[model samples]
Each structure stands twice: as C-alpha cells, then as structure tokens.
Target: MKRTLSAAALVLLAVVALPTAANALEGDSYGPGSCNSITPASVARGAAVSYSCSDFWVANQTVSITIDSSAAGVSARTLSTVADAAGDIQVSIDTAADPAGTYTLTATQGTVTDSSDFTVLDPADAAAAAASASDPSAGGNALADTGFAGTALPWVAGGLLAVGAAALGTVVVRRRQQA
Candidate 1:
C-alpha cells in the first residue's frame, strides 16, 4: 500500500510540473525594457513604418530612434525627436527608401528604452511568410524569437504521466490480488 501511494504521489507531482515547460516563451534576447513597438508590426518593401512611445521618463525629453537593417546596402541609422508635454512621441519611417528585410527599431529616452521588430518584404512574399509563421509545421513562432506559441512538449508529458499512472494502478491491483 505504501508503494502504491508513493507511485500515485509521483504521478500527481509530474502532472502539476509538466505545464511549466511552456514558460520558454516569456522574454526576448534583449533581456527586458528594450522598448515599446513599431506600429503595424510589418510593412511591405517601399512602404512606411510608424512608431510611438508615451512612457518617456520625462516630458519634452529627447528620444532617439535607431534602425538596424538586415538588408544589404542599407546600413544602420539613428534619428532623434522630442517627446510632447504629455510624454508621447510619434515618428514615421519611409520604408520605400530602405531595402527589403527585417529591421530592429529601438527608441531611447534617457536610460529607459524599448525595441520592436519591423519587417519589410515584398507584397508577394508577405503572405507566404505570414502563413509559415503561423503554421505549426514550419517551426511555429518563426517571426518571434520568444513567447508561448508553439510548444507541445508539456501536453505530451502530461499524457505520458496519465498512462503511467494507469499502468501503475493495474500493477498494484494485480499484486494485491496475489497477496
């Protein structure tokens, strides 16, 4: 009976612990407080991209905008603007003038900063890319480096734990009958 109880307890612990495997989708490579975001998330090649921030540490503060492009010929660029009296600032980028690829857009005010990923692709390529990013077979979360989107290992473990418990129960009953 003690052995059966121990086995049941182990199965309960495993079921509770399996769900935590999904925690891998939490943060990004930049640690935290990288920046806010770029509006629209993505844009076609030769289009425009916009971004805003309202969490500046101070009003009328100067925030720097930096674009680090992955496309060839188009190098990294940095620009600056001042936040309004309400600590909000809006800026736009002429993607039409830039190359086609992914770019990292970061905004900085004083030591506080935020960053977002902006993609510039041809219209024809955008749909396929979007489909693949959302498709589970093609490495789900392809566009995002972190966040909980495509993890199934936890559920698999939970199922396995249930099977093991059932098998253990069967074995316990058989042993009790023999005794």
Candidate 2:
C-alpha cells in the first residue's frame, strides 16, 4: 500500500510539473521582448528602416537598440529609447551611410535581448525588390520558409511524458498484484 501510494504521489508530482516544464521549453523559442520582425525587411542602401517590438519591456523602461554588421568598414550603431505605456518600442534608423550587407538589429532591456536580421541591397537589387514588393504574389522581404512550423515540439514532449507515466503506472500495478 505504501509503495502504491508512493507511486501515486510520484505520478501526481509529474502531472503537476509537466506544464511548467513545457512552458519553460516554449519560453526558449518565444520569450518576452523577442523581436518579432522588422518592417521593409530589405531596404535600399540609403533608406530608412523601422521596427517595432512589444511585451519584453516595462512602461518607461529604457530600451537599447543596436544595429550590427560584419561588412568591412561598417561599425555597429546603437540607439536608446524608453518603452511606452503599452510596453512597446518603435524606432527608425537612417541607413544612408551603411553599405550593402546583411545586418542584425537587436533590442535589449536589462537581461532580455532579441534580434532579427535585415538586408541592405545595392541599387539594382533594391529596384528589383521594390518591383516585387508591389506585386501581390511576391512576398516582400519575408523570411524564407524553413519548413518547421515551430509549435509542435512542446506537444510532442508532453505526449512522450504522458506515455512514460502510463508505462510506469502499469509497472507499479503489476508489481502490486504480484506482491
């Protein structure tokens, strides 16, 4: 009877703990203040770019924005602003002096940081992108579909946990019957 109670207690603990573990895993992929996207994801070498992010900051908190590039002769640029009451930060940066390259835009508030990538194109490519942007069929500056929908892993993990718990319960019941 004690063994049965112990087994039951263990199962109950696992059942209670599963959701918290699943949430932690989900948080790794979709944490607060994660940069969702940047508007006009591709831009002409000397155009303005804007991005908005929310939920990663508190009202009136100072958020630091950084644009970093690995292109030769380009230095990282940094900007700071306060989040609004809605805990959102939006900023526009002029890339007039930035050369054609891929850049990462990051936001930081205290310990939380998130980043997204954007591209700056030469005149010829920029014109092509602009032309495509106007076409309804062309998804302008969208991230490439990597074929992973990103929402399945947590469910899979939880399912596996449930299966394991069932197997353990079956073992415990069989042992009790044999005893």
lDDT, candidate 2, at 102 = 95
lDDT of 1: 0.74
Residue 175 error for model 2, in Å? 7.6
**Candidate 2 accuracy as TM-score:** 0.63
- For model 2, residues 1-179, the per-residue Cα lDDT tens digits are 57666666777787678778877865745655445578889888888888888665777999898999999999998999999986788888788899999999988888877788889889799998778867757866445568898797998788678857775876777788989
Task: For candidate 1, report its TM-score.
Answer: 0.51
Off by over 4 Å in 2: 1-17, 24-34, 129-165, 168-179
- After TM-score superposition, what is the CA distance of residue 86 in candidate 1 from its true location, in Å? 1.7
Q: What TM-score goes with each of the models?
A: 0.51, 0.63
Tens digits of per-residue lDDT, candidate 1, 132-154, equal 77988986674556666657777
Which residue pairs come into collision in candidate 1?
25-147, 34-113, 34-114, 34-115, 35-114, 35-115, 46-96
lDDT of 1 at 7: 67
Q: After best superposition, candidate 2 residue 32: deviation in angstroms? A: 3.8
Residue 130 accuracy (lDDT) in model 2? 76
Q: What value does the lDDT take at residue 151 in candidate 2? A: 98
User: Alpha-carbon error at 97 in model 1, in Å?
Assistant: 1.5
Over 4 Å off, model 1: 1-36, 127-179
